[model samples]
Target: MANTKAKAPPIIDFAPFYGTDPTARQDLVAQVRAACLDKGFFQIINHSVPATLQDAMFTLAHEFFALPIEEKLKVDANLNDYHRGYETFRSQAFSGSLRPDFKESIDFGPDYQPDHRYVQAKHAACGPNLYPASVTNPAAFRTTVDTYLAAALGLANDVLRVLALGLGLQEGYFEGFATDPVATVKMLYYPSQEPVAGEGGDDGERGINAHTDFGFVTLLMQDDVGGLQVFDNDTDSWLDVTPIKHAYVVNLGDCTQRMTNDRYRSGLHQVINRSGRTRYSIACFHAGDPEYVVRCLPRGIGGEGGEEKYPPVSVNDYLTERTKDSYIRAEALNAT
Candidate 1:
């Protein structure tokens, strides 16, 4: 949350993700994997989603927020057991010490299956999305948002494949856990830029309070205005991370960290809106299937003989705790 002018990454043309570019793509994959192992984050280019789609999404977001406060309140997130709808300023809480991120967000993801055994119980944090049926352009709105989600999900698949390969496993080593994963996409709009309005000298006091991602990985499309910062494990500095044109900002989540036994770090990421420019970002969260147990891998362990490293747990248990911190409940982690 400190006001610091950080250098933006040198802009690079994205040749890696485009078709028929094998060498470049492989190199791209290698770089991302390396970054994931070291810092657990990277900016990617050439994973294309049409400019038209991005534009429409922004347009609809504007209209959605412009609706009368009364109507917006009707869909406020607190009303539902599943927290997948309109969130007014200060609704969602962050880790202790930061002011509520000065923003409002619309969160949604793939619908849950009707036969999903635990739909009524496990997914109190998963529910129907809030959409204004009275929008001016529903067609353009749905198409663009859906396209953005699909694109991010596809990119996630590619990254997971590379990760499996990068880890010396068959390509689909991670695929078995991905069935009907609890994918989430959130649209964030930080308040209009203003002088830092809150007390400083403490953490979590910015437009975006700092926290590590909770799912497997997160793919984000941010506007040109820079505010994203990532903790640098090597430098011990919270370096500024700006969006590169045609690039997606990617980072590992806490679950990935636990599963990997810290092989990958789920570094802290935060956004500052100092430019006074309203920022728009579409972030997609990738998760494992609800039933997938996210225990440690054989290779991730290092026992007394330096053989293995971690205790076993399921992805479902990990993710549920991540989203609601109530999966095992506070008493469970605290039990004697």
Candidate 2:
């Protein structure tokens, strides 16, 4: 048992977490600066979520997914007024240049009251959740999710502070924008499937297609089943983002990249299910409200916006445009 656990997924070694020396954090700041400038991605240690919590979330999410297809489909997105509920792997057709993510996901945005259900032309968020009375352990599931989400909030807040330090801003520079942000945690499951070439297509037809995150920051806790890959902007290559014990990988989103005026970067990558076994992960996104307008960051020391390559626009418009392109081009079609 020990050997098997030892051989499990390889954890990411973040440069910021080497020693316990108090001043060591200064070095972490420097590391974060360099990482955000180059890749806008990093792995974190000492997150509030314990390893046990991570393990439990994965187990419960997978158990929920193992239900019959018909049972799971009962909570389909279209059925519920809100887009909450179960989504099949291929349904998204991300970018339409490859296969839909082989993994099925349960997506739930922030819950709201009927009177407060809002859909501004400038935002993509609104409405309530589509809960399936069918989930046998709904109470346990809610508790597990609530705990993980709280941890996510805590960690995201810390990361935002670190990002401020990285950007040479006061610690709370991003605090205002963090107000009532649209944070989401999607539980996903990728059942063991045939290898790509062994099955069909060079990239696994059933796995997640290449795409960049759309919010401020996206964090993922993945199982040992290794399939996640990240685009290395420095090398222009795709490398597997190894999962680390007691760590979760965090990446920048388009909205943030835009707001930072290119000081940060968003990456594009895909997953291939050659692991030949089932896998599970929880992806948490800390995104701005859709109505939020993204403009160039204050271009002082680390800021650069010579006329602002990207026009000031609401993330809602940007995401809607992107989503339309995603559906139109369809999978395996040229990227927008």
Candidate 3:
């Protein structure tokens, strides 16, 4: 994390979003709109996800990462085609110019069966997830992850409703986009690092490189050991995303920006763990339905407007292209 004294992003009380009061809900919508326009990042407090569940998820993350590399590889993501399961450290370079990220991760998504429509249609990200049977209490790990995923997706949906209203559209405007969504629940482990010694080392190596997310929105739960930083386009500097107790750090993604013709900023961000201890975070990337065509909305263009900045694209194609670009870099590095 940056110095504790540094400026922090806005933290909104999300309870109002679910309340019966229309005024309170609109107030939240305005706050969210401002945050998205200004920084593309904000923190949400008083969310409905249980603290106990969050704690359990973190516990599983710790336990899973502590296992020997051999054991972790049993559920390697490469085993499947849908990009689920374990990813080794230095396996990705989000910025393309920097060294590969120094973090390990495990990803899980909605486990659709072979007969399911999306699976049958061969949607790029739809398939059964790879669960690590090698973990102690494997059943607990699976159950905890599934339980938290459902809760996180619910919260993401509520946030989407707020976003729709914020854009001057109906609250249900985004509901259709969310059907049979492509939600990824990922656990990231950033190992402690010693400062780099040579030229460019100060900013070259990273736990994860600078990049905007690829989906509709990201809801992240990070532990106290924080190294997350959001880029400030105004100052051309990075601002640390400080950890907040029991709050999710929500941010917009490229797909959302495209759908809104850049009305919602999907800002750049990266992680660098200098805390001298491991850092854990759970990020749920909600990309909505694979088949939904992402087109600019009338409200997103505004009355004073210019022409649409992006052409129509399906959620599946966009996500697949981005994921393919990322792994291509990883594969190049792996071969060296």
Candidate 4:
């Protein structure tokens, strides 16, 4: 019988990127650039986030999901206008599919003071978080999540440096853009889906509908129970992105695709928990400053007077529009 194992995503280590050796860093940058160009997704290891911290995060997620429905609803995200707090199962869709995802999530961002500049400006993505006091050890949950968010943001900044080098720009080229990034960390819980419908199933019950992320980049940490799949444009088939010990799945998003003038495509991916056990994952979405104007870089536009394929757009507008479309679709489906 032919080998039936799914193809794994390319794996890259961050050690070289963090070291003082320029040659090693350059080589790593080249590898990353190639991977982005070809697949727009890769697994990163030696990323500096402690394994203990990762474990703690998974534990908190499991505990959160185990809370009573009433308790969980106390921090329902629907109560907030900025998309923070807990989202119940089957609350939203990924994109085209009107079917609700079979997962619950809690979204949080940088803890901005009420008078902070971003908050003062009324940036929807920058604000306080909603933590349920009903959960046992709410303090522990808060600390773990905050620490994880810090770590994720650090790693994201480092990756952006690598991408800058790969694109032949100054290492700090993206720093200004990220100064006040509209970042968000989401904790996702996917319940067991035993006896799942047969292969090629789309009965509006997927764990997460197929779609591309709308941010600049996303760093995802997943547990051992794997069901993540990436759509390969070349093969027109789904490739399983198996979980690797101590590795984070990194992928470009729609904004990055546009900034790169389609040189690096945003990966289309989804999750389906076929495992009998529940699945937990954390995703940190790092975007440019809300007011930053994004346009195709000269190199991204190709050589010899290549035309710009995308127009300049502020990060805030782009994200707002995307969010509107996503919620509109979900609301339409729910109303039916």
TM-score of each: 0.83, 0.85, 0.94, 0.93
Q: Global lDDT for candidate 3?
A: 0.88
Clashes per candidate (backbone, < 3 Å): 12, 11, 0, 0
Better structure of 1 and 4 per TM-score: 4
TM-score of 4: 0.93
lDDT score for residue 214 of model 3: 91
- What local lDDT does model 3 show for residue 335? 74
Pairs in steric clash, model 4: none
Say what the RMSD of model 3 is.
3.2
Model 3, residue 194: displacement in angstroms?
1.5
After TM-score superposition, the amount by which residue 230's alpha carbon in candidate 1 deviates from its true location, in angstroms, is 0.8
Name the regions of candidate 1 deviating beyond 4 angstroms: 1-22, 113-115, 118-121, 193-204, 300-310, 325-336
Model 2 poorest 10 in a row by lDDT: 1-10
**Over 4 Å off in model 3, which ranges?**
1-7, 198-203, 299-304, 334-336
lDDT of each: 0.67, 0.70, 0.88, 0.83
**Model 4: how large is the Cα RMSD against the reference?**
2.9
What are the C-alpha RMSDs, in order, of all predicted structures? 5.6, 6.2, 3.2, 2.9
Per-residue lDDT tens digits for candidate 2, residues 72-181, read: 88888767433567887666667544555567888766665466625332245445666555677777777777788777866777777777777778878878767666
What is the lDDT, from 0 to 100, of the residue 309 in candidate 3?
A: 84
| Per-residue lDDT of model 3, residues 1-336, tens digit only | 554343457899999977899899889999999888877899999999999999999999999999999999999998988888999987777645457788999999998888999999888778898889988899888999999999999999999988887887788888997867999999999998887778756856788888999999999999999999998876678999989978999999988998878878897999989899999999999999999999877653432156788999999999999888888776686677
The best-first sequence of candidates by lDDT reads 3, 4, 2, 1
The full ranking of all candidates by TM-score, starting with the best, is: 3, 4, 2, 1
Candidate 4 local lDDT, 134-186, one digit each (tens): 87888888888889888888899888888777777788988998777899999
lDDT of 1 at 291: 67
Worst 10 residues of 1 by lDDT: 327-336
Error of 1 at 319 (Å): 2.9
